[model samples]
Target: MAMAFNSDSELFPMVNVNNAKLSIEEERRENVDEENRRKDLPINECMGEKDANLDAIIARYAETINKYNLRNLGYPTNQDFNYDKLAPLFHFHLNNAGDPFVGSSFSLNSSPFEVSVLDWFANLWNIDNSEYWGYVTTGGSEGNLHGILVGREQFPDGILYTSQESHYSIFKIARMYRMHCVKVGSLFSGEIDCVQLEASLLSHKDKPAIINLNIGTTMKGGIDDLDLVIQTLKKCGFTRDRFYIHCDGALFGIMLPFIKQALKVSFKKPIGSVTISGHKFLGCPSPCGVVITRLKYMSAISRDVGIIASRDATITGSRCGHAPIFLWYALKKRGLIGLENEVHECIMKAHYLLNLLRDAGIGAMLNEFSNIVVFERPLDDDFNRSWNLACSGNIAHVVVLQHVSVEMLDTFVHEFIEKRSIWSKDEQFKPLCIANDVGSKNCACLMHTTYHITFSFLSTFVTYPTTHSCSPPPAATSITVLRRLQPQILPPPPSSPSKDSDLTTVVLMPTLRSTTVVATVAVVAAILTLSLLGIYYLCLTLL
Candidate 1:
């Protein structure tokens, strides 16, 4: 059955239960044995040229990365790119010191290419060449740093507000600047909770607000509503002068413009700056990014620094000039139509992967405008390592990049099904119920399916008032008492649906560590204590 999703971005992924503890132990042993097959050479040790140790090491390293690349499905990096044509430029020392547009006395810089690349992005982001001032950054993090820094420079006492699901770089940038940072609640889809954002804005009305909105989140691929965010600011009484909005569209920035009628990122909007990575969807061979802000804001960062004989505006004095060339090449080669085709192809592949998982009796979810197919985490450690999957506690996702084709997806699905079947032994495996995380309707687990499916993330109240006798420990509250001892006792499938309907409540303990549990409970108030930090940041979902 298909895992249907609501507009709110709820995802209840189904996972197979652990049948044998011994099987896991055996797999761990095998994994340890396999680790010995690939020995790491000590870098500090001297290599004799006569033995060809250097050549052997390079060959082994190349082979390993190639194999890993074949199975790579976790990260957002688009691996379908060729830079062989630009490899000739690697011989020279091409460094864009100081500002990209500003000509340096050092003539070895490739600032012309850098400027051209910046112009390309500026045009894509709806910023005119004459009206915008920006340079090719090291990557998305640098772009974020520069964008947010400009906001801080403009409004020195501004409070940085970002969704909790934002890239770690946002918070890191906040810390680096030593500015007051406010972590806002987000929807399960990873988009910013504008309701919560407005409340946060209202609370911090005394200070200037600097909002960091995601073009697309790192984990769940959620796109924060720019229009709604702007509306939220206005409702909270922050005008154009008092607030600065910096959009971090690291992955989605380039993709969004190509997407027809997508949330338009225009200079016409009341946005301070926009940033995106060249490596992510654009497929730059090296890490590179672009940040385009109004020409007016350039004065805050740019000034004559005598040593470099140019404006010292960027985060780093010397930038990787080659990165710009690579980005330029990618933009020139793909053009607008080529990129649009790749974007459509990726979204299609993501939908196909979702179907493959669902048809195999696994619950999965794909957001309406995302290429990230989120599913239940594989219980086996070796299986995760083999695919190089990126997994959180209960969920694992496959980012369907341009290189991830139907054949590769087919092989992955087939292998996953085969391994799961062998592990389960004639359909003995019970599935984990994630009704609390995703809504009940989407949860394909035996218990969740049997129960009422009307409950939502914030409203789904599961009370453990029953002191019903079980082989368990004393009670903290009804919910935490018996479940804490062996929380994840997933029930086996009943012969009939009516067989288990007599039971009032079946506790589906979440797969969260004590630390993650603290964060999780704080997010969605399942219990009575919803008000933490004077903010009712509701639970579950991906946001």
Candidate 2:
């Protein structure tokens, strides 16, 4: 039951959800590996004479995970972590069902570690313990649920406002809570359009606003301008008490605080709450997230649960006590310096991947201060599934996490280029233009291919006058977009000039005038010395 439709829309000429699911099921059925299925393993059914062969099964599973981890780039989960030291603790079952600050009667709980983790986040977000209340949830989705629920409880009649590019969970939360949701538009970068928001806010000026601002969007890794969003709310006559902001920093939440000049997400700002994924930038063995909000809003959400002998405000009952310890270990080990270094490393690797993609004539985009690198989706489904690429419409993204290395990125790019060439040659296919998706400057499709020749950062171009006097270079009619090519690897750890000394800057021009070079030989020979005299000044304008 497969249907094929054709159109220019990104959503069209694609696999339908229902058929895709059926296709996956059929594929799995047809390609079932009997050896890998552990069909011979026997489970001990209630005192029956059967051996589970648990050891062999566990070893097989471990091997499979190790193999999968190498190619797992579609998701943002960080695979570079270890919690082997806490293996003994896994023997006991633990649950922190109630509020972390208020310890529960369950003595087996790891509430102490949980509280410490929450405090660290609160302090990180610039909130005093007395003024803040938070808890570790299952993962980012729960954190979002908790944050938005707190907002709804605080302002019961508030209308939910979120951009079209927001995580799918936001709309689900809206539906779950039965709140009137206002879907706002977004810019090409996926940031919420402040103008559209202002218009929406003005249209519904009476209802209180519960804005879910994206610290980093899902696909494009776009960070909604928090400052601009706040400004728009105020300009639209929504005052301090009239609105609430919940910063969904799922991808960049914890990472942004470390990056220089990155938009600061803090309690000091008028933001009501902030949520970040523990397994994202801050890698964890388990799925978890933290959500912190103002203490003033606690009374409306929190309540004394007689059964648990503690306040039950969190979205779930019996939260994973093990998750908090895992988070604590990661934060403790990384500290500030280690975490900062990891974030910086991921972003640099992303840049390296982007450079590789573009250099190979494949269109790609990497956001400023984001680790997610977006590119044109591959035509071959097998090639896409082999690397486990996360795709939407005509675009696909590879979230370069701490585990993603230069070697792996190189391998991925090489394979992509090779496979892409084959696919295009076979079909005589034209590369898709993603100007509407990313931007004109980043697109490499046929219509926009000439733009690449307009300006490249790798070549040095000299515009010389035939006369012996210095002449002003004639300006081109079209504007050229300038791009930088930073070093593949950054300088080695903290406080050293040795690394900086090894670096050199090279000017690359995409194209040069077709003028004669015979007259410039006198200039080319003496030009090295003469160029140095004016190179600094000339570069200012030419670059």
Candidate 3:
């Protein structure tokens, strides 16, 4: 039977699943090649016939995997794949060596499938087939390696800039390349702090910039504002030719495109490259990713490899051919409509979990356009391991992936609330303060509880320039409350009072009795309020 690697063929498979495995008698009937016979001579002399031990070990491993998959709540991987129909592909040894755009010399390679997958991602990111060049990488880390390398090639003296919240891979790539790297601050929302970024850019104005923009951060799922970053670059005197932006959209890159209001990451923008993990939202069985960059950028890295008869531009040679097939199969099965529904469902379920936590008085937060529900870390390590929750410091997050159901969330929350009651009873185990992680409004700690009350009382009498509720800046180094409150003392108008004059600082004695006494009390309250906030903020800063 012949298999055609095309969109239609991938959509409707012709291969029979049961007939995929060949019997020993059938295998013996085929003519043996000289290389095969040579390889088999040594193996035949060393070993006997296959036994049931290997089968039993695999079965036990599968059982354990199935059990763990059910409780996989913390990771971004989608564990709902059925790729049994594609089992026939396992018979052939496949390797997609060199670039996907250039045909490989190896006949057994799955380059056609790899090209199809690359074309699909190219179209999604609004790059024409002729305009873009990419290859299916091992995972997101390789994608970063390639993208950053391209940026470095473009500007040899460029300084790498990425948020502190970005994946550990970005920093590692910088160190590997031996490029000067700058760690930018992030807001409480986990997005890159443009204010701090502007300061950094101005200081390093002599060198060109190579930025690793996070489409979605690991812990908080923060999407950096691409437009704002571009604006900041221009403001810092970095021209179009001087800067390169590589979007590391490991998880949200696929989901954000389907979202109507999401900031689209199109090639039309000034971005140099975009990369996404195939195993994340699309859910391939193994770790794989796609990185797409402009065709023009390939000139710096491309070199003809005579052996493979293709360009050696990719980060690794002999890439996983099986991974591309799996990626293509996953994408073909779930079209744009199917992907959108899954994305929305995950976000909705995240909101459901957030509500459950808040109802139970658990300090929790869910970002505006994210499926990650972050909350206080569980006291029990066994409980955390049971759910496979990813914890960072005082906070742990549940990445509401496609497999995480409403029922599962309910069960998890109920267990959490019950465990929390027991944990809270212990005097030594105080409630973890997460005001710095999630905003002051979201935090329900003893200090922030008083902090919230004081701010709420102040908001009644004082009109701030900005809203009272603001998330903490990166490192929680500054107080938003002090920055926003610019109190203007307005005296009553002589003829009549204007709306601006409503919040009066002074009035005539005849207008109200004991006006002096009232003013004195208000002044005293204001002094006490500032003193209390200062003490609390001081403690937070020291910690």
Using lDDT as the measure, the top candidate is 3
Q: For residue 229, what is the lDDT in candidate 3?
A: 99
lDDT of 1 by residue, 412-489 (tens): 899988877876674444465555444455556644533333223322333333455453323332233234443544
**Regarding lDDT, does 1 or 3 come out ahead?**
3
Root-mean-square deviation of every model? 17.4, 12.7, 13.7
Descending-TM-score candidate ranking? 3, 2, 1
lDDT of 2 by residue, 1-543 (tens): 999875434433333454463344444543454434533322223235456666776676777667668888878999888889999999999899999988888889999999999999998899998999999988889989999998898799999999999999999999999999999999878889899999999999999999999999999999999999889988999899999999999879999999988888888889999998998877788889999999899899788998889988999898888989999999999899998999899999999999999999888888989999998888777678777788988888999998888888989989988887787667645577788888888787754564344323112333233331264334332111111322322223234436333223221232343123223433554555444436544643453
Candidate models: Cα lDDT each: 0.77, 0.80, 0.83
Structural similarity to truth (TM-score) of each candidate: 0.75, 0.77, 0.79
> Which residue pairs clash in candidate 1?
187-543, 188-542, 188-543, 523-538, 523-539, 524-538, 524-539
Of 1 and 2, which scores higher on lDDT?
A: 2
